[model samples]
Target: MTEQRPTLADVARVAGVSRAAASRAINGTYGASEAVRRRVREVAAELGFEPHAVARALATGRGSAGRRERIEILIVDPDPEAMSAKPFYGRVLNGAMRALGDQDIALEVRRVSALPVDDTDPPFGRVLINVPGAAGAAYARRGRTVALGRSAPGVAFVAPDNDDGGRQAAVHLVATGRRRVGAVFGPATPCANERKAGFLRVMSGAGRAVASADGDFTRARAYMATRELLEREPDLDAVFASCDVTAMGVLRALRETGRRVADDVAVVGFDGSALAEAADLSSVYMPVEDEAESAIRCLLDPARPAPARLPTRLAVRGSS
Candidate 1:
């Protein structure tokens, strides 16, 4: 009989750790301390215990050895309710799912306030979305990681062309003969910051004074901000919202103040979401789905080139 091949169990036994720990270490998963991971990997190598990709593929019915992999999309939002309430979340998931089409790899979304404190079994990779810079740094240490929407130091990322999107909105407003504009900028995330910068840059260049207010990227906050903006600049004839959801709030505020959209205040927003279409709001359309797809590709292929900045275009509608 052929000599028995050493299994993960044997590696775990020799490493004096649980099979799960051994697996996690071998897979470069979180949970295991660096010391433990190094020890387990050393033991695995000594025992000649190699993971069987072909067997895993057969068991999972995946097309290739890589198909059995699992990638997680981590949305670092503390408020689950508010995060889910946004239409952009669903749109992002839709794009991610479409990008994953027919792949045997599992894709999951997880919400967390911060990176996991313990090294649990890590997935094949992770896509970080809406995470803070510190949290992103922590998660990237675990394994292959890709950031969506914002770039982190020493990590791969895919993001929409936010600066250009902002420029597009400003150009549209200017072309439409609107002056005395106001802006409802989103939360202080990098994406939002870029959009704000782009819009402000163009507006400043055009020699237009813009009344601006900060919003938490929520409808209620935007509504309040819009009210304040109008109060500060009652003669404002155009408003640029950082996102479609915020744009909705802006619309409500305008209506309550008896300002007709387009005629009284040409409104523009970002994200090119369904809400924008339903409300006939002109928006900068970013290719979110393509970004998601590119993120996945980056995670799967380590050698894949850095993702380029996805393009954004203005979707003109009745609102602008």
Candidate 2:
């Protein structure tokens, strides 16, 4: 087992002092004398018990008067390197860095996948980068972390108006008078579920029926599922693919089945990735950089009031 926790007794015994003395020294309380504090520091160093600087700083009010600097933009993605490589990743980072760049604060992108938190020093302050599932756990290590996602309360994470984006897609299909609508959805991501539910809501609201709905979060998986959906509804008039990658799959499948995009089966995608732009796919777009900025604000001023949802917009193109 790889554990990083340090016991108070370990620090006290090594210092040749009592636990009360060691605690007072670390806590910067009046309980310990100057000599006791000195011995406690020496023992802590020898035993490798890193002072919980963040926790200590809060209790002691040390360095609290300085400007709020260095916003920790923790990236919770499983693949840290790949996240750095992503075009959307760069855009979001640039957004965050640019915002803090003016304020002289740094944007710290930490991957929960690569370097796990050092419980040894426990962060002084934490702000969610994005993708709450991982950030939630990673920051939980520090104990004063905010969530930066849709519906993450008492913390900071931008919620994309996925439901509204979905409604826009459904309205596009309905306005075109497409009776048999089809869809390709990703698996249970917060953003994904919001977009899916939005589509269903709009369709149901308009008294239209969904010909087919498939759950897959990957490009390949969505491609296969879209192919099956097309087969299930040869007369399928419109389709909503949750993410841009998944939308690309849906478009490919529709073409393979001899359905013309917009002409035969209209299409729309979510997140607005590179493939969506390169292929010129019409889409409902969410500003990831704006989301990043919101995270920074929450970290800097907890009372700054986070957005309930980052506003979403639709970009109409050849697809829909």
Highest TM-score among the candidates is held by which one? 1
| Model 1 lDDT, residue 188, Cα | 80
Error of 1 at 100 (Å): 2.4
Top candidate on lDDT is 1
In model 2, the runs with Cα more than 4 Å from the true position are: 1-72, 76-86, 102-106, 111-144, 151-153, 212-217
lDDT of 2 by residue, 1-320 (tens): 99866776899988887776577687755335667778888778777787667756544444567533344655555543546344556766766675565543445666675445455644434655444565466555555565555534434456679889988888888998888888887666677788888999989989998865665545667789887887787788888888787787787787777888888888888777676788788888888778776665555444456677878888888887
**Clashing residue pairs found in predicted model 1:** 30-119, 30-120, 31-119, 31-120
Check candidate 2 and list the clashing pairs: 147-156, 148-156, 148-157, 149-157
Per-residue CA lDDT of model 1 for 29-68, tens digit only, reads: 4335678889998998888888888643444435453445
lDDT of 1 at 65: 39
- lDDT against true structure, model 2: 0.70
